[model samples]
Target: MRDILVTLLVFGGLPYVLKRPMYGGLMWVWISVMNPHTQGWGFATNFPFAYIIAVTTLVSLVKSREKNSFPLSPISLTLIVFVLWMNLTTPFAMFPNAAWNQYTKVMKIMLMTFVLMMVVHKREDIHKLIWVLVISLGFYGVKGGIFTIRSGGNDRVWGPVGTFIGDNNALALALIMTIPLMYYLMHDLRRRWMRHAMLAAMALSGLAALGSYSRGGLLAIIAMLLFMWSKSRHKMAGAAMLVLLVPLALLFMPDQWGARMDTIGEYQADQSAMGRINAWYMGFNMARDRFLGGGFATYEPLAFALYAPNPAAVHAAHSIYFQVLTEHGFGGLAIYLLLGLLTWRSAAIIVRRARGHAELDWAARLAAMIQASLIGFGVGGAFLSLLYWDVPYYLMAAVIATRAQVSLHLGPERRYARPKPLGRPHLDAAQTGPAKPEV
Candidate 1:
């Protein structure tokens, strides 16, 4: 049944996708983020749905005459440079086979992201794309939240297998990033029931993040909440809800959960934390020694033995910073950081320009929420080895696409192109100027 249903959706939607390639982009996001086929117990689990959709989307885009131009900006160029650098480092990788395989996956992600930039041009398209992402990730958020409540937060929340967010920490970070998007959707929605449902999803997603039992996730959620509150229009209501719900959620969790979280303060004594720190040191050593670094999958026991202080304790570069540092060297990390900083600045620019424009109000709100999401990734990512995860890049693309939409609405001269003063023109006409202006 699952196989049939998925096949039907893909084949049936192919016509529409061909007609409008953006639909295919949306489907790709759904498949990539949700990994719906992975939930099946049958042949669907092995189907190449995402690849089929991606190929179809690209083919359709090529055959069609739509203006599918890539957005050339600082962010996009930085991303291109980053991708090129990653490929350049792959040849020098310690484990060439593993590095090349990971490179292939990243290549697919970047291709789809650029496709998104081309097709997702309109306001409606942007909204639908965001909806796809919200629904895809929020499925886990709502499910995990209920599981956490039912299990008393004893078991951690994990994502579907074969997906980017398969681990508990990854799921928690994704959920934390999603809460702000949910809030934006709730406000953007018109129907009362829809808004209320989105509100429920937001609350549940927060609980789900807690259920992950990730100390980094805990910190990320705090950062997300702080930024959301600061950017919110109704500060009192946001604050009141935060004050009321946080303690209740904590009280509901089991003692084991609290005990696990307490390890954050005693990191030096915790094996996991110490392991991550050791990995960080090894990563630093690798980058310092090799200008191109060890490349992907180079965090092997041998590399650790060569660079680590305690050669016996080998660990993954659990930090994104360190992950990039070791995988692609300091140059790659710098480019990666530049991409993030530019993406963030792009979102901020949109928020500032869309502030007073009634038509672009949604853009402003979306940009602000996206900023919050990036903040979640930036903070939570420091402790997670999700350097190649595509979600953050997708957010960056959304930010760029949204800013473009707002710019188009504001016209070529942009927001400063105000209406000419009627009184001044009328006065000039009254003073015997050409009678072109209305009084």
Candidate 2:
């Protein structure tokens, strides 16, 4: 039955996707983020749904009348450079076959990310994209929240099988990033019932993050909530909710969960923490040895043996910063960091410029929430290997689209200028009387 439903939804939507490619982009995001078909026990579990959707979206995109030009900005430019750098380094990879395989996957995600930027530009289109993202991720959030409650937070919460966020820690970080997007939806929604539902979803999602029992996720949530509070319009109410709800959620977790989190500060005694540090050292050493690093999947025993101070303690490059440094070298790491810095600055510009304008308030609010989400990704990402996750790239697209929308609404000259008086405008000296001619 689940397989049938998923098939019907995908096949039925293809015609519409053909007519309006943006729908295809949204559908692709839904599949990639939610992995709805993966929930089934039948044919849908192994179906090539994403591949089918991607082909359909691209075919329609070429045929559609919508603007096909990519939005060129510092973020996009840096992304293109990073993509090129990855390709340049792939040939030099210590593990060529594995590097190519991972490169293929990352490139597909980057392609769809660019597609999203081109297709979803209108206000309604952007809102539709956000809704798809929220609904896709929020399903797990709501489910995990209930499971945590029923289990008394004893068991860890996990994401869908065979997905990027399949692990408990990954799922927790994804939810931490998602809470801010949920808050954005809650703010943008006009209907009271919908707003209330969003509020409930946020609370449950917070619970779900706690249920994952990820120490990194706990740190990420703390950083995200602080930034969220700072960006919120209603500071007092937000603070009160944090003050009231955080304690309640913490109290609900089991003793084991508390004990695991307590190990975060005592890294010397924690094998996992020591392993991550070892991996970080290995990445740094590899980048120092090979300018292009070891390419993708560089955490193999060979690389570890060559660079690691403690080669026996082999581990994945848990940190995003280290992952790039190892895979693409110091140059690639610089491009990666530059992309994030540019994206954050773009969001900040949108927030600053659109703050007082009622018309662009949605952009302001969304940009602010995206910043909060970045904070989650940045902090949680320090202990996880989510370098090419879909959510962060999607948020970058949202920032670009929102900034474009704000620019279109404000126009060129009027973006920063105060409104002129309605009375007769004061004429220039040349118009009012005599003026000197230019040389």
Candidate 3:
């Protein structure tokens, strides 16, 4: 049944995807993020759904004369440069075979991301893309949250097998990032039941993060909540939700979970934390010497034996900064950091400029939520080697798409002008102050 359903969905959706191209982009995101075929033991498990979807989308996009061209932003440019650097570093990798294999996977992710930028050109397309992400990953979040609640938070939450976020820690990070997107959807989804359902999903997703019992996940959630509340138009309401949700989640988790989190304060004594620190040092030393760095798989035991302070404790570059620092040179790491900075700035610009424009209020809300997601990823990623994870880049694409839509709706006269920093006068008399953030 599972195989048949997945087959039907893919084959049935292909014609529509070929027609719209944008739909193909959404389908690609859904399959890549959700790994729906991995959910059950069926024929669909071996099907090449992503490849088929990508090809169909590419062919359709090339044949069609869609008015929605890719937005030329700093974010997209930096991403292209980053990909080139990634390829350049692979040949110099400590293990060329392993590095090349990893490079191929990373390339696939980047290709689809660019495809997304080209096809997802309208505000409606952006909204549907968000919906695809929310539903794809939220399935795990809602399920994991319920399992945590039922099991008293004794068992760990995990993502699908053979996927990027398969571990307990990774799953927590994905869920944390997803909660904001879910909230964004709730604002525009007119049905009362759908909005309420999204609200529940957000709560459960938070609980599921706690259930993961990851120290980094805990810290990431803290940072996410702080920013979500601070950026919200109505501080009291956002604060109230956090105040209510946090306590309930705490009460739901078992004593063991709290003890695990308590280890954050005693990292010097925790072996895992100590090992990560050692790897971080190795990454720094490798980047300091090797112009192109050691490339992917640089964390080999032999390399650690040569550079690490504690030579015996070789570990993976758990930090994204270190992951890039080791895999690509400092120059590459610099570009990666700049990519994040520009993406953040772009989102901020949207949130500030859209303000209270009734039609574009949805864009403002999305910008805020994407900002919150970045906060979660930034904090969580410091301890997780997820440099190539699709979520962050996908969010970047969404930001660019949303901003373009806002500019289009504003018309030529108001378009192309730099958005004033927040708190200044609105761009035009039509623009109002920030709207009260949706509850």
Candidate 4:
């Protein structure tokens, strides 16, 4: 009974459907409670949801006959190889136990994230993700918003969107991540109400992020806006809405707008910047000297030995780029950059082809939003080790993979010309004729 059910859900269930909200919630709980690496299940780590979804996704593909070509992208391949290389070569010592622990954790879950995108190829699956996340955000937003107002607008009182952090920064970051999804639904949707709801969600998320009072979270929002504007002028509507709405927010803001704005720049001029700068400097020096990176995730101990004058105080580079340079080195860095370029180009191709075509409009919108999200996360990623969440990179991966699928007539609509049959050279399979081509 167990094997039969597993087989059925693995191959049959996921390709056609995203499990409904209750089911998804239940599964997440089960995974959190059952998974071992999630040794800290109730502790606000992303392991529960990100790792669970990733594992189920991989298990779904285990015996399936789906094409592995989807997973063969240059970036994904490089990441796999580089991950192996880093562990084998880099001397990670700050938290050796924690580092190796996270090492296996990231490789396992992140690769699974790649596979999840390959399986979830349908438009509705994306839609389901949007609505589901919207509900989650909305529920938490109201809770935090109410708590903020009640507590005289103190950020400390609000839970980080019901996360383990209990600080609102995590919530702010989560909301920042969800912006692309909201934009995807809003830009691509044909229905009037759905667009309005997405707009509302956008507003709530913006306010929620603002309420967090985290300098990093606010910069992330700004980065998201920059990416959104770069995509197209439609983003101006979102900007306008927020601009108009902020005055009202200021009325009840509790803290002066001037103080709030100043806080963004004055995040304490201590080691936060100094530490990151030191890490970055040593990382590049290491990269320049070795050119192949010290190995994957290998910057801290090496930096301590060479630059810090004390081996005890070294740390991971706050910047992912610097981390790549420090750990994976130039060769790994080159491969990483090339993968990004390829994905961006793939998304561009889809957007260009879908322009002004109604049937393909959603595909184009999705592609643009996914591309935007990747760039947004890339910006946020500079300041933190942010590989735990699966959405940003997975969506980017999906857009690239879907471009290939769409190019081969696998997306929502079958608008492309059907391939000619070899046996009866000109006959259309659905119609017994000499293939009367449509103009």
Please report the candidate that would top lDDT against the real structure: 2
User: Which portions of model 2 miss their true places by more than 4 Å?
Assistant: 413-439
How displaced is residue 135 in candidate 1, in Å? Answer: 0.5
Q: What is the lDDT of residue 184 in candidate 4?
A: 74
Candidate 4: misplaced stretches above 4 Å?
Answer: 1-59, 65-71, 74-98, 129-146, 149-152, 156-171, 187-196, 229-239, 246-268, 289-305, 309-316, 409-439
The Cα local distance difference test for each model comes to 0.89, 0.92, 0.89, 0.58
Instruction: Provide the lDDT at 23 for model 4.
Output: 29
* Superior candidate under TM-score, 2 versus 3: 2
Q: After superposition, how far is residue 385 of candidate 2 from its true place, in Å?
A: 0.4
Model 2 worst lDDT run, 10 consecutive residues: 409-418
- Residues 92-148, candidate 3: write the lDDT tens digits: 888888888888889999998998998887787888889999999899999999999
| lDDT, model 4, position 362 | 74
Report the lDDT of model 4 for residue 345: 77
Writing each residue's lDDT as its tens digit, candidate 4 over 72-165 gives: 6655665566556656544533436545665676566455555554554555555554555545555556455555556655554244333332
For all predicted structures, in order, the TM-scores are 0.93, 0.94, 0.92, 0.69
Error of 3 at 233 (Å): 2.5
Residue 407 C-alpha lDDT in model 4: 60
Give per-residue CA lDDT, model 2, range 1-439, as digits (tens).
9999999999999999999999999999999999999999999999999999999999999999878689987788888899999989999999999999999999999999999888988889888888899899999999999999999998899999979899899999999888899998887678999999998898899899999999999999999999999877789998999999899999999999999999998999999999999999999999999999999987898888999989899899888999999999999999999999999999998898887899999899889899999999999999999999898998888898889898897764244578887998888977878876899
Better of 2 and 4 by lDDT: 2
